[model samples]
Structures are given as structure tokens and as C-alpha cells.
Target: MTRPAAPPFAASATDPIRSILMNTLIAPETDQRRPEFPTQQPRIEVVAPLAPGDEAILTPAALDFLAALHDRFAHTRHELLARRLQTRVDAANGRDPKFLPETEWIRLDPEWRVAGAAPGLEDRRVEITGPTDRKMAINALNSGARVWLADQEDATSPTWGNVIGGQRSLYDFLRGQLEYTSPEGKEYRVTAERTPTIVFRPRGWHLVEKHLRFHDRAGRSMSASGSLVDFGLYFFHNAEALIAQGSGPYFYLPKLESHLEARLWNDVFVFAQQELGLPQGTVRATVLIETIQAAFEMEEILFELREHCAGLNAGRWDYIFSIIKTFRSRGRRWVLPDRTQITMTVPFMRAYTELLVSTAHRRGAYAIGGMSAFIPDRRNPEVTERALEKVALDKRREAGDGFDGSWVAHPDLIATAKAEFDAVLGERPNQLDRLREDVEVGAADLLDIPSAGGEVSDAGVVDNIAIAIRYIESWLRGVGAAAIDHLMEDAATAEISRSQIWQWLDNNTVTAEGTRIDQTSIVASMAAAVAALPRFEGDRFDDAISVFREVALAPEFPTFLTVGAYARFF
Candidate 1:
């Protein structure tokens, strides 16, 4: 009368009639298809880089796609209006290093598909720090990023595969160079070697072009082509070319905060694709809105990149810093903590995630959660559970918030990360008809905000320093911790102020708990920074404003940093 769980214990094919009778009563009522992002006619156009014309020798998928493309669109030219409509702007117009990579060797020109942008934001890719090197990069790749960043920026170490090391890694991946050792201690090899899954994040384009003058043994140019561009310039020159190369990074746009920023990126994509002979809209981009202004303009920024952008990400660590910075300047009650731990609390995290989810899902875009820099202990006895715990917590938060996926640092964690994310994205199906409508016709209002001149100007820098100094000094003197505020010792709002107290414990600039200030490095960095800035006269003018003008956030900077010129000023 009933179906039992264990079939192998008793049943066989002869029970089909019984199985059918049981199925009629107990079949599950579940959606057959997992809910998928609505698909569209492919928007990217791969121009021929070889001899023929607009078609290059196709990969299997490309060949099938090309055949289908010709069959479907051979009668149409309006299909290409998207590429032709790229912004007609000059590349030389950019003035900010923040906007450009050091060189334009590999520019990321993203197109904002109609699916991924919010109502107001256009998709604009900005550069964040490149991620760590190859093996970990493979980890990120399997982690399912729409964009894979091989970090050369802040996330990498100098000795352990930094710029030069990164370049070697890239060329090796590109060339498919690899070897191995046998289990019996015999040196053998892998018969198959493929490029590391993520794209290469070489040294900063500018850093490579300017500083790294590596030569081969014969004193020849390390590169036969001496025409290496900086990050920004290479983006200008080779973005489209990189796309054409097929094996270069598909692209992951980084660190953007506004629609105008997206516009500039779009314009760069347009010019590079057109002038440099790469396919239009092929180089995808993802944006990192890590600053205050970026949060407000999500809709506009996303939509603007509809033609060239990938997806938007909530850059948590940087975004958190930006949020506190904004509050310090704009809120009547301004304060920030010194420790990173206290700063990232539930409330703050919720606010960030809510805004991010609402914005990303509104347009059907992939909501990629931020990174967890938990470098694993390979030798640890309990590594598996430790990793499992880490992934479970992260994915629980991400899945509950409806994220498409999350990122991890090492390949070791890939299985756990994938399992957790895949579990969350269970098969909830939806139809494309309801999702894809022409909604952005008059929605230009979202993109119409006048771009705020960012925090790079002299006055802006001065203001930033002023707030930083006040916060730091308060921590040093122990005034901030006890002052009128809503804070725990661990809160970001206080960590920036109470860190020296923590520093006093272990000669570290900051720790979770403490009662006194470590004035050693604090005094040094503040002194250096104070020397770097303008000094206002005062009889014992050691408070924030004077300290700010002297050291851009004088008291705290030195507590954590060693001696350096930027320690004081630019």
C-alpha cells in the first residue's frame, strides 16, 4: 500500500504497476527547472581578427553559434545597432589614475546587458586590487565569479608571486606550461596543461611599464616588444584585443561608484573596440561600488553599462570603510572604530546587503557576495571542518540574501563553497516573457545625476585628512572610547579611534580588546604625516584639526604603518 525508502531491500522492475499506483498518490509537486536568469539573443559580436572578415575560425560552440547566428540574423543589420551605438568619445580625456589601470594592456570594456542593471545605475567597471596568484586564482575561477580578477593590486604579496611572478604565471598559463612528480618519488608530468582558470592579473599596467625593467640573460629586453603600456594605457590600447585573443580574461570590472564613471568606461570600450579592431561588447566588466556615492547611484550606474557591463558587486571591506567615512563627515554624530572586526557588525552588514540585493535583483543581475581572505592552514588537523564552517557561515548569509554565488581565496575551499552556493540556488524556475520588457525607455532620469567630483581634489583630500586626524587623536588620548557615542570597543565607528589602546597590548596597531594607547608608532606616523601636511599654529595644538592638517589622520596612521613618505603626504 505504501512505497518504502529502501528500494534495493525488496523491490524490482515487476513492481512497476505498484510503483505507478504509488506515484499517482505521492509524486512531488516541484518545479522541474531551476529558476534561471532570463536569456537573450547573444549581444556580443566577435569580429574577425584573422584574414577573412567578420568571422574568425570558430571554437565548436562558436561555430555552432555562428551557423545559428547567420541563419537567424543574416537578413538583419539592426542587430548590430548596439555595437555601432557605442559612445563616441576620446580616450585621451581621462585624468584620474583611479579610473585607469597603470596601463591599458588589458582593458575591461563591459556591456550592461538589459538583465543585470538596476533602474538608475549603469554598469561601469572600476579597478579594485587584483586577487592573489594562479592556484588561488583557479580557486576563484571555480568559485563562479562572472568576472575573475587576478589581483596585482593590494591583495598580492611581493615575494610570493607578485608582479614579475604574476607575469610568469600568466605567460605560463597562456602557453600551457606545467609539470609534476610521481607518487613513488619519480619525476613525471601532467599530459594535459591548460591555462589557469582565472585571467591573468599582471603587475599594475603602469607599474610594469614604468618600474619593472626585467631583461633576459643576454641583457636583451625581457619583452621583445618594448611597447608595454601602463595599466590605463593598455586598457585604452588592448582591451578589445584581449577579448579577441580568446584566452585572456573575459573580464571583471572593478571599483566604480557612479554613472558618469560607467559612461567613461563605456566610451573607452567603444573607442577601443572600434579603433583597435576587437569585437564590440566582448570584454565583459563588473563594477565595485566601494564608496558612498556609488551606493546611492546603483540603478543609474548599472543601466549605463547595459551595453558593456557585466554585473555589480558589494565590495564589503572597502564599502564599509567608505560608509564610516561618509558618516564621520556627514553625520552630526561622527565616529569610527580602529579595529576592522568591530566595524563590520550585523546592522552595518545588513544595511549594506539589503541595498545591494535590492539593487542587483531588481535587474536580474548576478549578486556576487564579497571575499573572505581566510588563508587556510594546509597543515592543520581539522582543516576540513574549519573550511566547511567558514563556507557554511558565509553561504548561509549569502544564500538567505539570495546571492547568485560567493567567492573564496584558496582552491582548498572550492568544494565547500560550491556545495554551499549550489545548495542555495535550488531549481526554482521562471519564464523569460515576464522578466524581459522594455522598461528603461524614459528612465534616463536615473542616469541624469551630475557626477560629484570625487574625493581626489585638494579640498576633498584636506577634508578626508581632517576627519581622519580627529578620529585618530581621540583614540590615542582615550577621549573617543568614553565619549558620547553608540559603540562597542569592536565597532568600526570606534575602532578607528580606540585602536592605539589595542596597539599597546602587543605592539600591534590594533586588537579586539584594550584599555591604553600604544604611542610608539602612532607618534612616529603622526609626526611623519604632520610633516607632510599644512601645520596650523597653536599653543599645544595637538588635537585633531591641527593633527589632521599635519598628518592626514596623524595619530592612527603611524600606529599601524611603518616609516614612509606617503605616511605624511603625497
Candidate 2:
């Protein structure tokens, strides 16, 4: 069946009121160009050259579906993002967030539950997450985990090549034709008998894909929302095929701040399913409760998408960044120490996770745990052993706390994580029955950041500077997940690092070594980090340094570093 065409934007010179409304809702401008196509049909203009194999995924039908999504939801997305900024401003002015009093009835209602798990998602004891490159896709599918989170957001750099090429790779894998040969002649392919269930993660609501402009307004082009573009292209090309194979289109929704955003996604799902002639709830999604605001509204979020909800995930790094971002202006009480010091065992984090487990279990949804960022260092046995011990302990904690499953970055860590879950869930697929009635979390408990006690140290500051610069450099070079100092560093980690630096400097945090962290000290650290790095061929590092300073030291904190960096680099 053919999908319906999207309505055109009000581009006529006579429609002054419609043009004013559109301009007010959308951003000021973007670097998008008009497509060479007839005016009646939807147009998808590509800003970059399509890679050799990109045609397999970016077919005409796929582009039309994407344009339809843009037309339907792009305006809503714009308004939601503007709401986010206004909320932040209110938060900074001491309008602290709490459970929505209006939505309390939804949470109090006892007769509701999220839909049952989709086929192949009944047991998610171990899920490996990474970018969608061909080699990584093959490795993750063969990693013996129950699910592979093919990430296109935090773990991907979103270069035009990476975006189109990654979609091509997923298409090839779904068709059982994906294979890769290394420079040393080693071949890799998916294991037919034990491939993990695929769950795709699109970009967050804050980002935009400048390469694909689908609408024109006032003689300027409008870029498609990145989240819609990713979701539309993937679902258009693969949804029916996945359902035929007994699995359906699954997603991990990232960086959502409110139940309203969840409602938006549910509406999109409804529209997409109806347009494609699929049954309701054909797409199941796991909401990542990674924001401080989202933690308070878990039940509401689930209710908004209950028909299409699979579960909720505890996203650790981004959660930290969100706390800092939401309360950065609240002074020392909200100032966090080193990122390394804030473990899951801390009071605030414990409150967050325990509430998550109880809420998900109560609603008959799976409660997934955070990622173990340790990448095994096989070269040094002691390093590998120590890291494995830490990972095992973390997993054991999550499983014992009633998490149905957990995330790991490397294949080597999967066995270790699964073993812990196996111990807790012997002969059982999950622990969704363990509804912890003892979990009594309040706003004060979730906001008790000061209980995490650790003084910032010189070493921590230097490490933050080093990791931010290093990760941003790799990000600029089109690599999202980089192994640095035996940990898998991605955009979330970078966000935490740079944000901590800004927080410390703004609050005049005194380090353990009797030195005060300030703009001068941070600048010195940045220069030192740059000089200590091994020689690189390109100016990407220089660009990363500039971007890092702009975000970290700005008078006003930018909501996301990736948004600015994407425009600057891509």
C-alpha cells in the first residue's frame, strides 16, 4: 500500500499569517538547500554525496515516508524543544520540578499495565550496544546477548556517510547478506543460529539532520527532524520484514524529558502503523529514563505509550549530565564531584534506580540497567581482571535489585553480565514479578545530590579535560564510541566531563590539592591535554578544542554540545 503524501508548508507570498506562525515555531535558519523535484510530491534533498551502497536503503519510497513523518510531526517537535528551553530557564530560576500533580491520577490508577512483550523480547538478560558499522553489527549480533541496541545517537557521530552507510549496513544484515573483511583478511558475518534481537536508537529530540531538507518556507529550506528521519527511514524499509520474521520494529527512545514527549512518540507510532497497514502497537519502545525530569514522570511516560511500551532503561551517564544541566545554577548543593566518584551506590542514584525498578515492575514492564563502560584490556591481564571484577559487581547489584536485564559495551563483558543475571534469575526469564514495595522515593531523595561526598581533585579535572578533548576529536573524525584508557567513551561521557568542568569553575570548587578550579585552571588543563596528545594528521583536534571551550566556558550553558558541534563540523 502506498503512504499518503504530506501537506506542503505555507510558502505562498500572500499567506503572511501562516508564514509568521511557521517562522515562530521553527528555528531561525539552517544550512539546507531546496531539492530538484516536482512541487507536488515530497522532496528529499541530499547535501552530501550518497555512498556506493546507500541506494539500497534510501530508495524513493523510503524518502517519501520520511517526508511524511517530517510533515506530520516536525512542528510539534519544534514546539517541544522550545518548551524544553523555557523549562530550563524556569528551573534555573528555582522552579524545581516534582511529580506532575495533574498526572497523579494516571499514576494512582491501578487497573492499567503496559502491553505484553513483543516476540523475541521476552528475555533481555544481556543487551550489547554500539554503533551500526558493518563490523560492529556483526560482532554485536554474535556477542551471545539476547539483544543488540544498534545505536545511531550517542554512539554514532552522525556524519552523512555514517548516517546513510549505517542504514545500509542494517538493511544488509536484516536481509542476511551482511559481511565484512578486515585489512588482515579476517571475515565476519552474522551467526544465523544465535543473532540477538535488534533494537534501533534514533537521535534525540534536540538534534536536526541538515542534510535532508523536506520542506521550504519563505524561500528557505527546512531540514527534517533527526529523530523522525531516523525512525521513518528504518521503519519504512524494515518494519514489515521484521514482523514477518517473528520480531517487530523495536526502538530505544533517548533523552526524553517529559510525558508529553512520550505522547508525541506514541502519536507518531500510531500514524506510522496506520499508514503502513500494520496493527496497533506493532512498534515497541523502551524509554530511557536518563533525564532528571523523566525520573519523576516514569509512570506517566509509560501510560502515554502504554500500548507500545516495552520497558524503561536506567541511562547512567546521561542522567548525570541531566542532573547537572537541570540544576547547574543551584550552587554547591547541586554541584557534583568527579564523574568517577558518582557510583550507582550513592543515595541519589540508588533512589533513581530503585524507583525505576519498582515502577516498571508494577506496570508489567521490564526494568533494564545501565551500561558497564569497561572495555576489556586483554594486553594487560591485571587490567582486564580488575575491570571484569568491577563489571561483575555492578551487574550483580543490578540483577539483585530486580533489573530484568542490563547493558554492556563489549562482547567480552556479556558473559560476565549474563552470569550475574543467571544467578538471580535461575530458570526464569526475568524478575518482573519482584515489585519492590519497599521502594519509597520522594523528590528530596531524588534531589539529594549533596549526599554523594567526594572532593574534586586535580587528577579528576585533568582527566575530564583529557577525555573530553579525546572523545570530541574522535567524534569529529566520524567515530562515536572510542576506547580511551580502557573505557568506552561516547557523547554522554563527554557531556558529563565538560559539564563538570563548567560546574566546578562556576561554583569555584576547591580541589583536594588546595587549588581552586577556575577558568584559568581549565584553560591550562586544555592546553596541556592538547600538547600531551600524540601527533595527529588533521585539524579535527583543533576544532574539538575550540568547540569544547565554547560549550564549557560560555556564560550560558548550551543545552547540548553535539548540536553546536554538528553544525560546525558537518
Candidate 3:
């Protein structure tokens, strides 16, 4: 006998989004270059939404969606109404949630998107150094970065910059009171620096509690007793300070497990905002969604922090290891794919992405993809080109599949990543249209703002045209400022990420008009946008390119990066 359909109260048809997701052509349009979007009617599929700890409260929207489905079918089968609410007690099967009369709903984990602002060698053509030290920091900022993540966490000059993350320094920095020089020869501005923007990843709760000392009673300093207690302490202190400072830097919450964790974060943010005398709803969040439970609870995780969570990003290696250790014994027989392969081509990644995009788009947030850590080897131009081709294709496919942006670990790769991000975006008018429509239709939701560690910001997204122009404009600037050889270390990695995000636009960017580029330049061009930097006017660009190639492709490279590493994703 066939399994019974759900009761009348349960959705008579599949959710509209699920229907639309089917046959959704996500590939970027080769001609218009528009990424594919879902356009079909909803397809119904049976799924048990409940996981062990999942709880469900039918939101008004879910209720409305159900009503719409019931309206669509006039003479729907009588069995539907009877079986929809079938009790687990009646079935006697243990596969379903034990709780009867409760809708089975396991929220999926949210995906995270890397900001265009944070500093990294891959995103920005420059490297960021130092915590509050201006010369080193500015040198890194001026070199270029979509965003300079003011270090507090992993990239925080582990030794020197550690002090700068203190409440006072963090507060002043966020207020735009910090000063620094730009690599473009501009004198340092005193009040604050904006061009090379910053996103601060706070010290992981564990480290801050252990290492960073704070003032105590009677104005004396003391070591924290417990990391767990210190997590709450540091979070409250720094998170509140940031809110009071009025800076727009957002958050990157790491090592989470479920919606409850996100809710805990949301609770902290709410407390910080209230006590810090800050405006409400100014902050936005980027959830790492790294753990196995997080992946399963994505929908609810975001639900709690609806408006606060701006984007959900898929973390790579860290998450893979997290998954393995979570159930090593149970999954031992089912070995994971090769490390390199897992990084690029995620086998069941679609399930997660679909749930992420489906729920995020359902709730209205940007769906950002994860990182491609490979830095193209320029020694053999072919090696670099081949690596580039693989990820470019992957990113292109991701965008087509509904991701708004992706991450690259190398600064040089930032231009490539952004160019691909923009290429997939197609016309500006269309983008504006989609955003306006989505936001207007009540698509976006955030439970709280100014998420954990203050990582994601409400700062403007780099426009496709802006991203394209910079990639086409700069040439030698990056090569001279930084090295692109291998991103094994965090500094080189940070430089690459920063240059790609921070300082690519100019005062005239909004109004300037020119098509100094074409498809041919994009397709056949193997040159780094930085290679064309104004600083290197003549053979300088070529020489810099040569330097990059020599270093990047040197045979003394990592054993795995041995040759064409991009193919590993596949």
C-alpha cells in the first residue's frame, strides 16, 4: 500500500518555494549574463521537517501559505484531511518525531556570505597588519581591500594587535576616529578612514576569556577565571561598546550549533544595544552556520534573528572537520570525499544551499557562497589560468544557482571573484528591480541587528559595475604591493582578501562613464587587474606580472597545490 498523504491542515500542496525551486535554471545567462532564477509553479514533495530538537510555531506566513494551498484545490482527496494530522501514536513507527499534534519542523542552518569589505589578500590586493598601529594598518588598507576586517580574532596580528581590540580602542575605531594612510599616496586623514573600510572579528569567545585582560573592581586588571564565563563577559563588553560607537561594522558569528545558539547571540546583541545607548536595528549579521546541527536548524536559526541576519555563508574546511568529528564513529564507513574535492564541488551541498536559499529567500536575506582557497600559480601561466577557470566556473555556477556572492582567499582572486560575481549579475536595472521587489514584498527578516562580534555591516554592497570597473582598471598596483604566491599563511591570505574589498572605487565612480573593457579582454586576459596599477605605467606592469608568476608558480609550493589545484573541487 502507498503511504498516506498529510492531513487537511498540513499543506495540501508543496510549499510554493519548493515548487519554484524545481527546474530552476540557475546558470548565469550566457547572453544577458543574468543568473538563473526559479519561475515554475510549486512542486509538492513529502518531507519530515522535524529533527530531534526541532520545535515549530506556525508563523502567520506559513499559515497563510497553507491557506493558499487549501484554496487551490476544491475537490481535494478526502484522505488528505484524515491523514494530514496522523498521530505518531497511531502510526506506532519511531521514525517520526515522538511528539504528537506538533508539526514536524527542523530549522536548517543559515549560510554565511563574506563581506566585500573585510580585509584579506584575496579580496583586497593589499595585506592588513597591526591592531591600532596606523602605519602598518594603513599600508595594508591603502594597498587595497574590499573591506579591512579590523583584527581581533585570527588575523589580529596575534601578538601586537591584541591590545588594540580592547573596549576603548574598539569603541574609538568604530566611531571612525582612527587615522591611517592610504597606499594611493594620499596623506593620512586624522578624524577617520573610510575608503578602506573595516570589519572586526572579535576574539573567539574562548580566547578573549583566557588571554585578553580587562579592568576589574578598583580599576585593577585580573585574568578571567573561566573561558565560558569570559565569553559572556567579553561579548557583553565589546558588543556593547561597538553599538555605542555608532559604527556600521557587522558580525561574523562562528562555531554555532543551532537556532538556540543564534538566539543566544541575538539575546546578547539585544542587551548590548540596550545598555550601550545605540540606535536600534542599525546592525546586521553574517552567520558562519558551520556545525552539523546548525545546518539542520538553518531556517529557525535565521528566524530568531530575522532582520539581523543579512546573509548566510557556507564555511569550508573548518565545517568539514566539524562534520567529521560530530559523528566520526557513525560515519566511519562512509568516508568523506577527498579534502580538495570537498572544498570545491560539495556533493550534497545542493541540499544545504537549497534549504538555505529557500529559507533565506523566503525570509529575505542575501545567500552568499563560501571560499575557494586555491591561489592560481602564475609560474606556468597555464597553471594559473587553469585554476582560475575551475573556480570561475564554480562561482559562476553558484551565482546561477542563487548565491549572491562568493569568497576568495587571495587578493588577486578577489578581482576574479568579484568580476565573476558581477558578470553573473548582468544588468544593473535588473538588480535594482529584484532588490526593490524582494524588500517590498516583505521578504527580508532579522530578529536582531549588529550580530555577534560585529562582522556584517549595512554598508553598501559593491555594485557590479564598480566591481567590474576596478578589476579592469587596476593592473600593477596589487603585484607591487603584495605577493600572490601561496596563501598558506594568514597575512598573505588577509592581504589578498583585503585588496579585493577595500580601495577600488574613486570619488568619480558613481558618475564616471566609460567602457574601457569588453568580453574579449575578460576572456583572453590572464593579467591581474592590479598589474595595470597607475603606479606601474610601462613595462612595469609586465615586470610585476612576471614577478607574480615567478613567485606564485614556484615549484617549491605546497605538495597539494602541486599543479592545477582547482580541479580538486570537482
Sort the predicted structures by TM-score, highest score first: 2, 1, 3
Clashes of each: 76, 0, 91
| Residue-wise C-alpha lDDT for candidate 1, range 1-570, written one tens digit per residue | 221231121123244433542232222213322122213322212221322211212233332322222222211211111111121111113111122222121122232233343221221111112344444333443443333456544344232223333444344433444232446765433232222224323321111121222222222222111112112223432344444455332334444444555554565455445544666664455566565556656666666666665466666655654443333322212223333233223454555555666566555555567655343555564755665686567766765666655555455555566566556554432111122222231222221211111111222222233335544444333222211111112112222332222222223223223222234534544455455544445322264444333322333332121012112311
Q: How do the residues 203-277 of candidate 2 rate in per-residue lDDT, one tens digit apiece? A: 998788988886643344677788988898889889998998889999999999988899889989998998799
**For model 2, how big is the CA root-mean-square deviation?**
5.3
Worst 10 residues of 1 by lDDT: 83-92
- What tens digits encode model 3's per-residue C-alpha lDDT throughout 122-144? 22222222233454344444434
lDDT of 1: 0.38
Task: Give the TM-scores of the predictions, in the order they appear.
Answer: 0.49, 0.93, 0.47
C-alpha lDDT of residue 557 in model 1: 31
Q: Cα lDDT of all candidates, in order?
A: 0.38, 0.87, 0.38
**Candidate 2: residue 475 lDDT (0-100):** 96
The superposed Cα distance between candidate 3 and the true structure at residue 265, in angstroms, equals 1.1
